[model samples]
Target: MSRPNPAVFIAFLVAVIVVLGSVTLAKGGFYLAKHEGDTLHLLQILFRMASGEWPHLDFMTPIGLLAFAPVVLFLNLGLGVGISILLSQVLLAFILLPAVFWAGMSRLPRRAAYLFGLSVLVLVMALVHGETERSVSISMHYNRWAWAVSYVVIVLAVLPPREIRNDVLDGLIIGVGLAFLALCKVTYFAAFLVPVVVGLLANGNTKALRGALASGLAVALIVSVFATLDFWVAYLNDLREVSASTVRPAPGFGLRTIVMAPAYLGASAVALGAIILLRQAGEMTLGLALLLLAPGFIYVTWQNFGNDPQWLMLLAVLLLVPEVRPELRNSFGWPLAQALGVAAAIAIAFAAPSMLNLAYSPFRHLSLDPADYQPILVRNPEHHDLQVREIRANRVDGVVALDVPGSGLEDRVGKAKRDEERVSFQGTPLPYCELQMGIVAWFEAIVTDLEQNGFAEGRRVFVADLFMGHWMFSSLDRLEHGAPWYYGGLPGIDSADYLLVPLCPTSLSVRKDILETIEESGIAVTEVRKAPLYWLYSFDRDG
Candidate 1:
């Protein structure tokens, strides 16, 4: 038995680092900007968990709950977001490196194997870069990261080794890895299962097949039970609101879509052409071709078919090929084929990197200066002057509400008022109001925050809009009329204590009606200077 080449391992490690390092650096360029929803939400959950709070199921996406739980648990020792992301990326690279090395060793010569691994690394980097570039606005979405991680694991696990019996553990490990991937994103479950099923049928391993099937079913059962229970408990406690919303864009079978088939065919043809050229070189050359082609086929098919099982049929043709059989070892052509195969593999490996450099060039042109954006802590003098002073005086610890009024502020006020009207107009019909109120129903959040922070002792709470006062003051145990309403709601509508309401913009009837109701309800309304964007209204509930 030949000892494994240390060079192959070293090459694999270097490739993995290079791929991950480049992507991470590119992502870091946008660190000054706010992370997207997925990342923020994940970090929030992690923070809460680390602080000894139970992970809130409602706050997580279905698959995210599983993917985040371990990371949060591991990072509970006060690790920051940057450290957590780095750790995740490192784990992904380690998991991928072994598979690339094994796949190369099984099919190609040591040198060819190294080249094969290098090519895969380049392709993966290119794909990830493309995904990251497209996801700039939504960088916080953790699921994309989760999916990328799963893709790396799945490809490595599925690659066949040179000596199948020597690596019996690979299949079981793949099975367990697939289970975790399925838990994170159920769609990938098909990707692993289909290939396993095909391999079993081709090999005619009844006992092994039975075990794989049983294990898969057992995992599915356990996950489904847990998820169902979670949903029920979360919903009944009013901790989660479930709504069915979907985007079903019309399927386009355009010229571009048609063009994709030829591209894939061309890639496969090139890979096979390399294999034929390398035939005389050795069994390792053929094995390298099989390893690369197998995962690439699975990935391409899944991209097109949305993870259909029928696509596994393509692997059957691979099994039938004469060169794949163990008995045929060196029967194919030699020296000339080997040279051509090596040349082709090297060419294909360079393709992805060249394309990626072209794609990333545009982003590289932009300057990533933090000074371009305003600081979140900076006070807007026009709006925060009085409110900041008042907060300083009263020592309020929570968010200070502002009393700015403009079309933007009115939209929020109008939405709240309209939702309230819709609920009341319908005679307080339980479900009707519940469904129509949207997020506005959470008006109690302001008062809840205020009370929890002892804001009542200060006898005043800063607000962005006077309309927000309706919700805050109504919920307060006692109200103060002279208390200032801080202008904070819409940008450019900032005024301290003086409520700015823009009338040049058409008034939303809901805001107008709500204001009248507040006035009738004994909330004093003082109208001040009217600007093109907002009108000033001072409300003193204590009067």
Candidate 2:
């Protein structure tokens, strides 16, 4: 690494404190603009953890424990979930501060290093998931945190130090970053693991490899000691179950589209061009490492919900740092340095929208009028700080296809012989109904009705739909072994006293899958009651 710049590091620290503090002070509470469903799912995990339950053992989820651990820690300390979230991001930034500092100071110029640190911190602290959207929400926050770690890891691995070299620090950063990925989101670990190792080796940083291995192992040992060795088995089982389940395999576009679709093709071209330019500039080792990382980059983007190519900033940074001679030129006779600069600009252009959105979110949150929002977890007045739009919490909306038989719309749409594909429960054909919004209202109403009907506190009713966030709002007990968001295979069903099937489900496909699976299992269930919201059926455990 180059001689460390104290001024740059100090400036970065000040920026972190000022930015995060300003946002926290501005909101006075956490405010969400959208994605209430995701927030509720997060609350379920946090609620369970706060209640002394363990993930994988007490609930089913493919997400790793570290994803929720930081926030849960603050929650257990008596902070509201909203502040817990903000504090967790602050904690993550500090946890990663040394690595970001080392990587930035080692590879980048003073200004670039400061920007690098600031960017990573902004991503970690941003209230919204990445996109061009101006609205703020803490949806898919773990994804953002994983991407921040990835940015640090890639920079550290791909760039050799300019002058100073601390092999121990380098290895520890790589190891801790990778271990965090494994414990927070395994998809990132699986995607970048090989490439990171190859990058370190290709750069001839062999001395750091042993430290990396030791650090990673040490992290694993600690987790096993606390969460127990069986945690790995349960974790893997959740992963395997989700992998096999047809529900929500991908959040947005498919893998192929993420790789080569029109929206993504330009970024792919920029990455390839950067790789080739690095090779042409005679930086063969870095080029090869980047080439290997390209696929992993695409895989991570495909796995994330919005498919935001957050790695573009890292690409830009890498392009800026190569010390190629001024005279070097590619086949087009374009000066290699300028070519790299132009490529970097294009990468920045592709990433600008999301980056700007992330950087500006805290300030935007400051401008929101508090009178417009309401507490999401209505029963938990202590968590009144976590707020959402009142309309979103109260107004329910759904979409149902028109079934005008005489109009022949069904036939024209190829639904004439849809019987084989129709969703049915107990020999009854279900309509095409899907809830689109007001998830808070949906769950709150169900729980309220359930309590009023004498199916009160301590009851564990498994909703036959995608999300089971019922316990977060009411006195009802969280379903043992239940999934916050259903990935499939009827998790927690055996432990459920009653199955509540929503007439209009959040995901019709998930409801269909769950009901079919239940029927195949031959679990006898008799109707208990029916309401406008859902049908409650008690399991005939003896039968």
Candidate 3:
């Protein structure tokens, strides 16, 4: 079959973007089903950037600048938050479109190229973060965006060009994709860099290697000049701080679980099976390169919140060779081509749920009833676009064990020692309770409670909890140098006026850790105000 026209593929991708973008915009806002805390964190970052603050400079975050820069660019142009976010994805797809086209056209067969382009575009434009969850959310949108970029880079590097080879062009794409991953989220860059380099070298793409290095260095130099040399140091510092955080080291599941857990074992086996089949088919270099790439794939999945295996779709495509020779057989006497085909099909099956969910999310958004949702940022009208379901926003839910003094279970157990480890602040033990939902209500009530008591304006509150988004809901000023979501250490503590300890904190362990760290630091805090919702303590650093 003749190769599909490159223009036709590019046009098809653009059309999909336009259709998805239009449908997303038709909603006039973004509605989230879950992950309100994460959405708030993203809001804080965008707000800080809009107010002339930079990540790792005026604020603390492990997320790289590029993650928010695209949205910030649209925001700077005076667009609403929802519109900015939507447009940013559209912009990202377009930005990465050239590389997508090149990789698809050069490396993949005609139909596969179309599918490849569509996959990248879907990842870029999808409203919800990847998962089988039908709910729509903008949380961790950057991760999806980063994965899209990774697809392009891996496709270009691992797969040899079937149609035409342009070493310089291929290298530039790989370099820019790597740099974008670095600037957007370093986890991807760190995970894929070695394997990508190895793949290029294994293929003897020497000119592409040189081109990649120069382009990567050039991009880094330009960023350094613009963002200043201190930016890199600050970025590294933020990453290091996050790395040490006991409150939240990894979002979900351990690295081992990601690779070996029952839920993930099938995908992992399929990946390994692909490697074995590739080698059996006399593609030793490709197989070896894939072997090196597997750990990185696992690492990225382990690092992400939902632990969705975003690499499977790409792996499925990678396994699809232009020609599958029937003569090749493995030691088991099975035809290598058919075995590879089965493996790729299994990979697709593993990936289909999330991929289908991602592709269908915008349509899901369109069907949502406006009456069912309310704005997350209650005070800011410009942010009226960011909304959550009223039930999720208004209804607070938590797990509270029946530990009544005369309860039969307690009597039977003779009082568990775990109860002895209750989190305490200022020598008073806090209730062992944690909030599982109603983040919007939590923030709104606290802000209102503070306002009612005249501790509202110009106060920098260091919330002793997992998330610090109270400032986003009210007139309260952000904790200078504070984290949107606490990673580790007492960030912005010295600059804080009050340490607000919630009655029902989001993460009890986080609250305990923060309070303990503060106590160890010897920062004197005196109880200033007590309410049903929280206890406010005035920081006395001088003492």
TM-score to true structure, per model? 0.46, 0.96, 0.96
Candidate 3 residue lDDT tens string, 441-514: 98899889998888878888999998888888787888888899888888888778889999898887788888
* Number of backbone-clashing residue pairs for each candidate, in the order shown: 35, 2, 0
lDDT (0 to 1) per candidate? 0.37, 0.85, 0.87
**Could you tell me which 10 consecutive residues in candidate 1 have the lowest summed lDDT?**
382-391
Q: What is candidate 2's lDDT per residue for 329-415, written digit by digit as tens?
A: 878899998898899889989988899889888888888888889999888899999999888878899987665577657555564
* True lDDT of residue 431, candidate 3: 79
Range of the 10 consecutive residues with the lowest summed lDDT in candidate 3 = 412-421
Shift in Å, residue 519, candidate 3: 0.9
- List runs of model 2 lying over 4 Å from the truth: 1-4, 405-421
Total backbone clashes of model 2? 2
User: Mind giving the per-residue lDDT tens digits that candidate 1 earns over 448-531?
Assistant: 444454433334322222233322223332122211111111211112233323221111333334343443555454653333
lDDT for model 3: 0.87
Model 1 misplaced stretches (Cα beyond 4 Å)? 1-7, 18-57, 60-62, 69-74, 95-160, 204-244, 248-543
